[model samples]
Target: MDTDVISAAIDFGLQKLSFTEIKINQRKVVESFLAGKDVFFCSPTGSGKSLTFEIAPFVFKYLQKNDMCIVLVISPLTSLMRTQTQALNRKGIKAPNKSSLGDVKEGKIDIIFSSPESLIGHERKLLLDLAKKNFIKTVFVDEAHCIKKFGLPDKKKKKLAYRPCYGRLDEIRSLVGGHVPVVALTATATEETKAVIKKQLCMDNCSEIMVNPDKKNVTYWVHNLPSDDICTNFRWLVNLLRGYKQATSRMIIFFRQIKHMADVYEYLETSLKHDAYIDFKEGGPNDNRNRLFDMFHMKTDDDVKDFICTSYMNPNGNIRVVLCSTSFSMGLDVKGVDTVIHYGPANDVDDYVQESGRAGREPSQQCNAILLTYKRCLGSQNIFPSMKEYVKSKTCRRAFILNIFKTIVEHAHIPHFCCDICRLSCKCACSCEDECVCTNTCNQVLPKINTAIMSNEDNDDSDDNDDNDITELDDMFSSDSDSDVLESSTRKPQVIYSSDDEMF
Candidate 1:
């Protein structure tokens, strides 16, 4: 590594990002990029993965003897582009996202961020025109794993993939005319996924800088449920919040689909008002929200769930929760988010790892990654081997995830608490240095959601009951029929639902 590149990392850290020092891995990435290598980089969240792009302009100016350096960033998410653009500009670095190529020629903007579609769209000619003039020094593809999952959506499930432009990213190299180095970076990608990115981005001569994707302070927990429905599996999550009293911890609940995300986001807001709580001892739903809130010393006057439903970049201590989708995974840098809840099966395994990696970013903040879903994740026919094992295997969840990117460590990596499996088996007992380790009895420290409740969820209709549920059904089924016919039909499905049917 060049001494100049090493000095650049320190200079940018101390003067720009306000850090005492940069990591060795971070320094190496900078060195490789500045050497004009098409770099394939992968590291976990909170590892300062963005440092390479942040200090690139400084390194370019230092190398080329130029006053201004232009770096174009091709990111898949719009929210990520906006967040990075805002943060950079606020730091006196004039970076433009979703802006014209006019800014590039103006010679004031240092960094530019955009979605793949934008660069490949009508703006392609303008962007290529700028690249032709050597106005854009280097091109960056942040969250590069998308190049595999979204770019090449499987033929069977092509509709699930929204950004097909990721597959077409190879055109970017031709447009830039091979002068600029395209750096592909992401937090999660298996060796197979890496190969896909390399071919898609045309990084044939790319050097690699990969690191372990395991987050030490983060704990992983999976609750295999009976059903995949949002209302069914997410009950425990609701109860976890209902029973939670902590004001310091922040959370992000991720969903792959927008409808499910909206449904749960809306439910958390109105659940307290609708007596959504279940009391197995007392049997069925009841409104004990005020009692529980008072017990937890929770804030009642504030609209806690009135968090930014759309953009989830800013971390507010007052906002306890933010519901996220696949797009928000890359750019979410909220410092205090210590709890990450992933609902449903991830269409792509990389998205699951990336989304879960968002929590516990701050060194002092211990976080939890809770998986609430059924056995199967998306990618149904072609699931990542390790992801399938990690979900079902009763092994060290931390090690299982780490091996995805194959984190090379000097010795066995000791996590703060290995994971729920390791904790229960006392396998993590040796991992933690403290004199005492949590026994299997310590599950109380975590929430106990009755996932099997879907099997036991019963509607006790009294003989006097004449609610409007029958009307909600299609008219062809029961609009003309008497209430007795509807009752008979409802009972049949309830029997199947109540049975020991975990086939899903």
Candidate 2:
């Protein structure tokens, strides 16, 4: 199992920390990184995905017996880039910003951190110069999902004048120039997003490591609240705070809109008035755009932690809660987060999964995820209408969530390929005779399925409403009915052949 290699990697990382911390999953990722292969890691937030790449260079340096630049971690969020650079510094490793390429050329750093845009200018010249001197090796794209839209739309532009420059990623590739291996990392990437990364990075053959998206250690429960009062929600939050007061835990509460964030913050401040123990950091959506930039350029671990707890007090303590929107969900890793309370229903399953994934990162069995929802007019419709898919799916909760990606991978056969893992693992496969293991499992469980059907039928017949519902039930059971045929199929068939001339 390469336990010594794993231990050495841990020892290397632990030198920077005062406390003892060992992450097995992080070690596995390090092993993959050391093999000089491109990886697409699907670990949840707070599961130490960043540390996986951070510790890889150290291992590579020891084994390869050289001090060359083995990693170039490109992050979309400035905050994340800064956080990573600072973390490297804490470990006595110099990971400077790409903007300081001139300084780096004089042997001032071992790693380079920058945004996709920052690497395109004079920075590419410096990197190429260093490459001639044999100094660069591996490239890591932190939030690789953004590479999909590498040069599409300026964030400053509000109108629809967005034109995509497809060659932007290609330009970066030309700069790197095939000398160093590239590892792209992300917490949430659809199949389309991954294809964009592969194409942009110019990786001919890439290996993927998919960490199960389900955080089973975190128990999930939803609350149906009656009122839309921010103050009322504050009281409920206060109760949660009191419960976790003494426990060493962190929390992130998600809001749907900027105005909702402001409302919640104001209500908490006023209602919890002068609660010296409580601290909050306000991350307004507009400000978050720049905050990400600042985070990428940060120079220390303390700065990274500070940004995480920006809106909360005692960030390093056992309990800290940051009230944020969707911006906080992607590529942010923190440990011992006991709860992630969504103040409102998420817009889609993807958003919900990513947000809920923040809890129970350390493999504990007692973590909790509380979702608070209410009936509110999001425009003319419910903002969370799509949640019905999750609630109504006949498949297991985990299977249903994973199938969302499977559907995408199936539909988007770009670069002339489909998801092989989905085909092998999904329950939708036909039979074991077709070389499917899930099909065998399904067949073995068919008796239970039959029992369930009988039980449902018995219950339906025993119901008091059965007699009154009989006429409607008869209409439903009439398979030959025109209404039934129309409702069952939404598509009109087209005739593809004519046989009148052949008959003559």
Candidate 3:
């Protein structure tokens, strides 16, 4: 890979850009577009991570033959793929998917965008063969966090299944040659998640870069309320939207479940009695998917701005308030997101951070990320206690986030552990933090919960099952931790504080 030529192409692209002036952080990302080095990048949303990878194929084009260098971006959302493919086509680039696989095989496509599920079947083999012949040069995993197994398993099987890939990533990687440099990009990564990703991609020695997580243009706030009074909360949301509507600003509201999404949309359309447009994705004759593309995509005649729907819809609408699930939190970037409201609790701290990071991408906009939950149900079993601890904790949010990554880093280095990436010892120094802040804050806060939830018998059963599967899988595919420092670290002194005033 000629790094100098790649840099020159990036410079040329940025010089002729319009609309938003490219930020310095984005320029730094473009500079790191080198070949033969797997890169793990964590940047805030709207910081131009997509642009960095968008220009990457140009680098390979400089080094390889014309149309010989193909770029494949694996995104989690089909809607996102469609939007990106449309945008790329407008730029006169050939980007196609299974719907147009014929065009791709006819040598009509320079870029191919697909979701993990669509990349698993017979069509993938043909692409894999072409890729091995050097037709596909670079692979980019957008919304890399989905590889960590988002609630897909839970929702699909109605239970939490821990099988990370569901046989997707492993299958896809096997098709592509090992030498093909892979790039994993996300807006949020806990130390644990980073470790998992590195191990999964076999990129232990990969260079890592992160843009500042704390955005000065965005404000963060948390509200505790009663779960039963959800309607009252919806009223507050309406008022919030009204306040922003007066300013003619755009906003997004994230929900936890599809049922809740439907309920909120119904309330807004009926009780609020607003002419605001609503779209739900329950598959049926009247399903939103039937008309979603025509309604949301700018190419359509729909002028609906107050888009009320689940995370499944294409988010191209000039909608003032987009009600969705956490699925909208990753990869897809929208500018002028003035506010992000969480109607329910998040699954974990990592989730909370990713969702909140969506607001205030524009440097001059005053955006706010508000976390609202019921006060009485704060200690509910369904709600992850770690989130409550984060909201109520006194430590710097950045320190807390870094600490999560540090633990995962240490876990990655331990030998004989069958992680997603390798089978042997991992030798990578994850210098992510100035100090380990988790030892004091998160260690002691959950002993009772851990003990109550985790039993010796449960451990034995789970361990036995995991060992049997690990041994079998490791043997089949050839893929696939310390006490003293742990105990002393747990004994450190700590401080705790409470929110004195209610945010709402």
Candidate 4:
């Protein structure tokens, strides 16, 4: 391991980049790349996963003074590719928008950004050639969970999107062989999903590092409505949003079906009179979708000038709400989303995690997540155990999500404003007509338990001079913290109520 390379990377990040923090996980990731090991990483959204891969190569190239080093990035969406390329260019790195086999052979570009399909179809031979000669240092797959959607397509015509190009990622691995390192990055994935990614990419003995998935600043709420009254549910959602303090804050309303989105969009336009935008497939081409996105972000009018000058004030009533389906879930990065409202229950917990995690990206801003659903639709949508479990569960909502991904942390460390259950708030108003007892205990205040708090020390790898070794990396992974582990006694302990209590 080269300490100089790591140090140089940190210098570049702090001196040149914006809002950059060289986390311990990032340092370990770069170290693994230097040692020639494959990596499988799972962290929460807005955790800066891109920087982990980018810093290592930048540092490596700077140390060797090799401007010819080529790093290939494979993404599922073109929007994501553009986002990364633009960011890299801001850091003074040469990432070409267009390049050919001759350009790659001559090392005309430091990084090449392409979608999975383009890499497999247009640059297949060139990429394999670079791998054969060990010219490519690392092959990165961002949003690696797309492997499940595209790797094995369903024969039934129910899914909205499909791509056979993702299946060919395995071919890239076979040609690259064991000498080259491959890194798979994603914000959310279960252990089973992780296994599929590792196997699909032919990653042998890959290292796994999972950052804490719990988002402490965002509060979760569930609104249970009558299964038969769809109109009433929309009205209820409209009232909720109308009551929020920041009327112009960015919001995404996710619908399970396209028809439901259309229905709600009509109501918001006619009744609430909000400049709401609708985003879904089969509606129009990408140009229209891009226009709608700009409107929602308040980037399309003369008021945009004042909005930017005043830090996004919205004097001209800009578009704030976007009604969308699952297509809006992945690959789109919108910052400071004040709230995320699910028009219905998600297909499963993983989907719920990924969708809801979109909010509270900026740690300083508080965000909320609301799930509106009916009990009857839970089984139809494969929401097993029940949507009632989520709305009525007596446990901390944060704890419930963390337990799903098998994360272990003391309850005392969880934030006080964790969720509706932790705070004992029943906004659902579920009546007993459906045998739901949640309404009965809505007003009861549960006792908070006092326990030892778990804390992780802040480890600053930028200041360290020691070469990053495997032994230090193992300690970081085993402790289950993104950075360093601090002493529990130094922090104040939190009091959280247990979920098993009958009145919780």
Candidate 5:
């Protein structure tokens, strides 16, 4: 990194972005962008992925280049596009109105943040017009993994066909030019997914800068809930929250199903009675989801502690706690989160890596990631092989994730606050210390997987009246059926697959 670039980044972080210093990864990404290369950069959440793309306009401004030379960011969701728009506007940068196709063609906009759906539909003509004038210097695909899942529509599913823009991202290269730079940014991408992204995006000779996915500051663990009862799960969560209430206070609880989220919310809100600070959030069939989203991510001085929402709930505040779903994974940029608790094991280790990556984003703060799992969900879903191996293996958890990246690390390379296996082997620094070895006096504690039995309420056998008694939530899925809780085997598949591209 050049001294001028480094100094400029630091000044921008402190004065403009309100950060004390610029991150190394941020510097490298900016350098790459300045070099005019198409980049496939995989960095952990909160490591400044947004800044990598956002800084381009500022650099161009500094160079006294054509102000019309702008960056086009293609995000996966409307919520993310809105979030980016708000953040950039805060820095006094001009953000294109997402609804106005005319603003895209005007060439006065410094940057246009949009979704693939918007690009392929509303803004297609204007965006191509700008591309023809050589107005867009770079095109960024944020959360590029969605290009695989949401790209093509599964026409068999009517809802998915509504916005089949996800699969047509490769068409973005055509909208712009073949020679224009495309930067694909994602926090999590398996080796298989990477190959797919490269081919789909037409990045035959794209250079990649992948920082190690492991966050040494974040400690990982799996907690086996002894019972299948939702109440039992509730009790365990209360205890864990109470324990981490002090220094490592901020947290997010992730869920795999909407009904499970609703069920847990009922128990906590109705039974436990912590409704003010804690709330339930989910993507809706309408703007209701978006409204709850702004309340959480758009911080006001009045905001309080403990928001219980879906993974779609963005952590904007110095949120001490969150309860959400898989939608929370990828490209979330909140900092100083002390913990991330998954209500159950993720669908796969890749999902696990992305969700767990949210914690301990600030290098100065060591955070904890706890995965709570029940035996039944595992049996019903046939948990991913890596996830199954992750829970049962007597090896280093961090090393397991690293191996996913095809890197080999010996036991000797394990960090101080190592995983359960490393700690049990007496390889952790706290092994000899009666008090916890953590600088914060927190021990590498791995509670025995609970042996509690399922309550009758959680038992599978039930009368027909159970379906009639269910309450409707705001989401698209009907919670009354087991089809809602189980993985894809039982539910209506969200997207129909025409090729292997849709599988992941």
Candidate 6:
């Protein structure tokens, strides 16, 4: 392994790029790439999966100063492609947009970004020609699950979005030859989908790394929206947002269908608007129009980017709630989203993971991901089996989700900060080593559990004497505690409740 090269690559990522820390799996993926091994790795969305492959060719070029150490990246969405291209350029990598990909052949560019259709249709010969001479050092497949998503042909009427060329991705590998390494990365992939992705991408003997997809900082729950009382269900959200200071807190409401999204947006907009306490002179904040926005596939790429950048990234920007579809999910990383609401069940668990992963990108902030559903969506033919199970499960919500992905972490969060099921049933909410800090992010969607004082086995009030009275306990736990016994209790508790928990 090029140890120095690898170290340099990691440094470049942390210092030049926005990556925060080194993930063990990310390092291993980069090492495998440098060693000329095909790599297939899965980590949570916000974990910076792109850096694993990007660093390989980057370090390769840095080590030998070879402008021909080029990499070809096959991305799924055009929005994602544009986002990455700009990010790469920010770090001084010569990754040109699709319009300027012709420069790749002249060694002026270090990376080439293309969609499956464009790669196979337009740049097929250029890539193949580059591969013939071994100039293309590595091939990358971002959001590799798209091969199964847009590629597979259904027996029923094909949706216009279907593009079977995704299944033909192996042709690019076959033509490029096996001498060049291929790296495939995704935030969500099941065991079955894993086999499919490997076979489709010709990653028969690739080195694989799988990280647990659970995000501890983000809590999870499901809210049943009764069909009979639409206003009642919507009023709940309005009340929750009413308590939050929209400037610092953010929420994302996702929809399976655009029609329903519009309806929900209209209701939320009208409700969230500044209310006159008594038909006041004006209103509290009629600026409600600026408080919400909508994002969907219908919007242009620039519009989507603008929504994300200004609404979430820009502090002065006013958008605190977003009504959107799956279009806002994939590869769109937004930090500090305090809540995420799914208006209905997603088509599958993978889609759920991608869409909900958009929230809580900031490590310091806690997010609550709530899936709102009706009776029909629970058992719908289009819904994934595990997704349905998730809505109905009474056990640990995080445990159930981890089981779906076959991932295990040494420390599962205590019941209180875990999920609705665990919070309601967990006998050991205090088991987590870290002090649990209730961020107040999940009050409306999930129940809160206070495990500070253990309950008596006999359910007796005998142990609840004056010393241990609730009033005194509050003082002990309060910020200004000065008592010797309450010194440690003064600091706020911080049990994260937590893949793409940012990958879309």
Best by lDDT: 6
- Identify the superior model by TM-score, candidate 5 or candidate 6: 6
Task: List model 3 lDDT by residue over 143-255, tens digit each.
Answer: 78766644124454354533334225756666887776777888778776777677766676776886556555554554444333456656654544443433334566775
> Top model by TM-score, which number?
6
For each candidate in turn, the TM-score is 0.73, 0.62, 0.67, 0.70, 0.72, 0.76
Model 3, position 75, has a per-residue lDDT of 72
Query: Model 1 residue 339 lDDT?
Result: 78
Q: What is candidate 2's lDDT per residue for 331-437, written digit by digit as tens? A: 65555566677765565565677778776667744465656654341221223344545543343444456666663222221110111122223353245576554
C-alpha lDDT score of every prediction, in listed order? 0.60, 0.51, 0.52, 0.58, 0.59, 0.64
Backbone clashes for every candidate come to 1, 17, 7, 3, 12, 17
Under the 3 Å rule for N, CA and C atoms, how many clashes does model 2 have? 17
lDDT of 4: 0.58
Supply the global lDDT for candidate 3. 0.52
- The superposed Cα distance between candidate 2 and the true structure at residue 281, in angstroms, equals 20
Q: Tens digits of per-residue lDDT for model 6 on 347-405?
A: 77887887788876766667778887643544334556687777777787777877878
lDDT of 4 at 86: 62
List candidate 3 segments past 4 Å from native.
1-3, 11-33, 97-99, 151-168, 239-248, 274-318, 375-383, 394-504
The 10 consecutive residues of candidate 1 with the worst lDDT sum are 293-302
